[model samples]
Target: MPVVSRFLGIIIAMYWDDHAPPHFHAKYAEYEITVNIRTGVVEGKFPKRALRHVLEWYEIHREELIENWELCQNDESPKSIEPLE
Candidate 1:
């Protein structure tokens, strides 16, 4: 997994050769969730407030996320994304 962003204690990552739906992983403390880059649908668990932040960040970086997803699918390292301020 390559970490692409980190802010407010949240870690965002994309895995190499990962599954479909083109998702990225978000981890905060003990919570970890996989969010689809296209739809912003999340799978797994995260605190409500934290999830909101992640969704907002996703909205801002949707295109970048898709690009990174493609890179990861080809076994390339994902580039870092700007974190939500």
Candidate 2:
């Protein structure tokens, strides 16, 4: 997986080869979450305390993020994520 975005306490990434439900990974401090790119749902492991930041970022970037995720799934290059500031 390559990192798509990185900020203070969050790192977003997508695996070079992954399956569907269309998701991405977010790592914050010591916790990690896999979020569904299309639905703002946590599709996999997510510790409670780290959910807020992940959800916030997802809400802001969901559209682009899901597009990037599909590119990753297809083995095509995807545009990376940009930090807000």
Candidate 3:
């Protein structure tokens, strides 16, 4: 997995060959979560303590994250998260 961002203990990243439903991978030590950017859903298990920050970050950048995912899917480099309009 290639890390795209990191803050506090959270690491936001994307795998070169990720599976369907297209999402980002977040890992804080042993805790990991696959978040669905388009729908703001957590697809896998994550630590409750980390959940709040994760959701907050996702809510703030969901649209851009989805767009970045599309770019990644197209074999193009991911873009920075743009401000929500």
Candidate 4:
């Protein structure tokens, strides 16, 4: 997995040729969640406050996330996204 962004001690990443539904990974401490790129659905667990930040960042960067998803699908390096304030 290549990290695309980091904020509030949370690391966001995506895998090349990963599983479907166009998603990205958000990890905070020991908790990790895979969030759907389009729908914001999440799998796994994360702290509530951290999850909020992750979703906010997702909303702010959905388009870029999709673009990165494309780049990842092609096995190309992903561009870094701006972190949440």
Candidate 5:
């Protein structure tokens, strides 16, 4: 897994050649989740505050996330994304 963004103590990453739906993995403290890039569907858990921050960041960087996903699908190094301020 390669970390592409980190903010508010939340780490966002993606695996090389990962599964369908084009998603990214986010981990905050003991909570973690995989969020679908296109639909905002989340598959794990995060504190309400952390999840909010992650979603906000996601909205702002959705395009970058998709580009990273494509790079990951090809086993290429994903560029680091901007973190939430």
Candidate 6:
């Protein structure tokens, strides 16, 4: 997994050649969630407040997320995105 962003102890990553729906993984401590880039829907477990942070970050970087998704689909390394401050 390539870490694309990190802030507030939340680690956001995306795997090379991952599955569909253009999502990224957000991991915090023992909690991890997969967030769909286009819809902002999350799968798996994460704190509500943390999830909110993730969603806010995602909203700000949706275009970059999609670009990274394309890069991953092509087996290319993804670029780092700015984290929520």
Reference-based TM-score, model 6: 0.96
- At residue 67, what lDDT does model 3 achieve? 76
Weakest lDDT window of 10 consecutive positions for candidate 5: 42-51
lDDT of each: 0.94, 0.77, 0.75, 0.96, 0.94, 0.94
Model 6 has an lDDT value of: 0.94
The candidate maximizing lDDT is: 4
lDDT of 6 by residue, 7-68 (tens): 99999999997899889999999999999988888899999899899999998999999999
Better candidate number, 3 or 4, judged by TM-score:
4
TM-score of model 3 vs. true structure: 0.81
**Tens-place lDDT digits, model 4, residues 1-85:** 7999999999999999898999999999999999999999999999899999999999999999999999999999999999999
| Per-candidate TM-score against the hidden true structure | 0.96, 0.80, 0.81, 0.97, 0.97, 0.96
Name the TM-score of candidate 2: 0.80
**Per-residue lDDT of 17 in model 6:** 78
Better candidate number, 4 or 6, judged by lDDT: 4
Flag regions of model 3 displaced more than 4 Å: 80-85
Candidate 1 residue spans exceeding 4 A from truth: none
Candidate 2 per-residue lDDT over residues 1-85, each given as its tens digit: 6888887667888896887788888887667778877777775565564676677777888889878977887887778777645
RMSD list, candidates in order: 0.7, 2.1, 3.3, 0.6, 0.6, 0.7
Which parts of model 4 are misplaced by more than 4 Å? none
| Residue pairs with clashing backbones, model 6 | none
Model 1 deviation from the true structure expressed as Cα RMSD, one decimal place: 0.7
The backbone clash count of each candidate, in order, is: 0, 0, 0, 0, 0, 0
* Predicted structure 5, TM vs. truth: 0.97
lDDT of 6 at 76: 96
